[model samples]
Target: MNKKVILSTVLFLSACGGSDSGDGISLNKVKSNDKAKCSNSRLDSCYYDINQLALNIMFRKNDTGVLNVTASVSGPKQDIYFTGSDVLEIHADGEVFLPTNNGADSLRYENIPDNAQIYEFFWYRNSQLVEYNSIDGITEPSVILSTSQHDGSNTITTDWLNNPDYTYQIHTPSLWCTNLNYESEMFSPSTGILDNQRPPYQATLQALYGKNIESLKVNYRSCDISVTLIAKNNQVNYRNKQKRLFIHHDNFSEHPLTLFESN
Candidate 1:
């Protein structure tokens, strides 16, 4: 697949809401956390303060593989999604085949690290090696492989080039900060005392797809905030949930507290 084409498709989806389902499966709401107390008299009542949202996918292949995806408010107006995928595989004598071709190549058996399991082969358009993880073992043109931490957690680590010019490396870690600022402006009232004090926020992106990703969707107040980036990870995992809170003081008067993502 063309990298630019894939990136563009993901970005377009992030910007515009689509059919909400792909690859012959429909997405079902798994969980949500929404809590914003505003009476009918409040101007912000039109918006819903979101706490948390998550989606879980279970493949029909077997009970051993699953994907857990979560999204949370990072600032007054911003939200971030984190996802993780778990897969189980078969290895012969603790050795697995690592393929070099983009699905057309042959797999060569090698002694992989105890912590590493042959998953799939990652390739650039030219078929250069990018990374491999366990999920790739099941994907077409399986060139990428994935290895997990072996702690029974979904955390998997793979080799990714850190070159500055690499598109995926440029936007990560910084996009979280940039998103916080962008969201503050969007959620602030255009005219009011609260306008001057936009709520503060922050966000983090986790990769569930094994490689870096580019598009994400955040939900706030029944509205979805689409985030398109120069680069991002395929999924994100957090030791702790990303949280944001907003405080407004108008002419020496303080408004009640507002939480970004409720527990």
Candidate 2:
């Protein structure tokens, strides 16, 4: 299916078959990141901050087990919506002010459910749907993450375990990082293009359905082995000068169990 269709399917699947709470969730203190550099008035900064805000709420829900979350985010983009069962609205002008290259834009979420398994964010540019982020596999209370620019181009599936230092093995076009006391690890290269010659960290990854995937299935370590679908991208290798896919093995050692998926 196409990327748009895949995104729509992801949203539909996330919204279906989940326990709902009667108490709604809310978000407060929404502020855009003014400290960011934006050629187009801080697209990356604005987008990143808002996205981070949503993720922060998700993690908070996991930790506290609160049924509703009320938080706010500020960034460059305006007319943004955080969609799940209900919508978290964004307002362009708010009470707070920040020192940004662009003007301050604020948003807030009222009564967000702690049991919300999926989150989809829609961002607009010139009244057009420029980008959207779909977060799924959040049923478990462990850390949650969707794909980001930092992941380069690989589709990824991540797991966080209570016990650490476990050796993991998966098929190629796949890599596992272990041998440390990290509670979280991510595995990839599951049903996508594989470029063996390139280093794992430098490779550009893609999703199975489309390039620049906005939807992902998140899971905890239910089994010893799991598979993830890598998305598409055009990152090249400097040494070989060829387009390739690589493996990523990140063991978040030296840090306690905190979610690093937002960066």
Candidate 3:
């Protein structure tokens, strides 16, 4: 299966999901950092603020969880995401972890630490080296995830303890044909016949079928893990979230708890 189908994306341009109700969460103001250095903005040593930084951890059904953290900086390619070798440091309980960075825009940390209740996503940004952060924790569904596919549709069942108090978000891919709807419409007969050249009915049907033509013969291609997040409401007021992390919860983890099989 192609691993790139359902790439996880969170917020950046603004806030969403809900307001910052501290509840069990905590946050720090984007404050001054003594280590910040920006003698000049045009130099490689200067660090710029990122569009977003996200840390996502998914607790699996039968094994350890997966961690994925990314920091996105919007600017010319000459500028780097971070100023130093240290990509990100996560503080959980009394221990600190530096997620592995293979020189990509994101970091990968495997197997969330046991006994971890609170997490501080820590990363660097700006010429002043102002610290960016968010306080988020892993929320396991009350009941494990189970999915069944029938007739190209998906049915997901989960127990969220008190289902009324929480909601679930399913991140999955649909038939690729659905995504190419606009392109398929271009081939429709109504699009108008060319100069002295009318489109044939069989040819038009073939063009409209496109990718699904293969699915008709070989079924469908398997997709990425269909991840789910279970969340509840909180009344506490935490520091307003920053570009550091934008998702109430990310779409997936490195591990698969549930999937949408090919039809």
Clashes of each: 27, 34, 4
Ranking 2 against 3 by TM-score, winner: 3
Candidate 1 deviant stretches above 4 angstroms: 1-117, 120-184, 187-263
Q: List model 1 lDDT by residue over 1-263, tens digit each.
A: 11111122221121132223322222222222222322222112112222322212111111223211111213232332221111112222233223222121111222322222222221111111111112211211111122212222222222322323222211111122114225522332122211111112112224322212222223321111221112221222121122221111101111111112212
Residues 1-263, candidate 3: write the lDDT tens digits.
Answer: 11111214421222333223343322223333224444333322233323332333222322234344344333445444343422445555544555455334444544445346555554433322233344444443334333333233232222223344333343222222212222211122222322221111112223423333334324433422222333432321224455544334322212232222334
Can you write out model 2's per-residue Cα lDDT over 70-130, one digit (the tens) per residue? 3233333443333211122211121111111122222333334433334434333322222
- TM for every model, in the order presented, reads 0.14, 0.23, 0.42
lDDT of 2: 0.28
Worst 10 residues of 2 by lDDT: 236-245
| RMSD of candidate 2 to true structure, Å | 20.3
TM-score quality measure for candidate 2: 0.23
Candidate 3 similarity to native, TM-score: 0.42
TM-score of 1: 0.14
- Scored against the true structure, residue 6 in model 3 reaches a CA lDDT of 24
lDDT of each: 0.21, 0.28, 0.34
Residue 157 error, candidate 1, Å: 26
Please identify which of the two predictions, 2 or 3, would achieve the higher lDDT against the true structure: 3
Instruction: Arrange candidates, best TM-score first.
Output: 3, 2, 1
**Which 10-residue span in candidate 3 carries the lowest summed lDDT?**
193-202
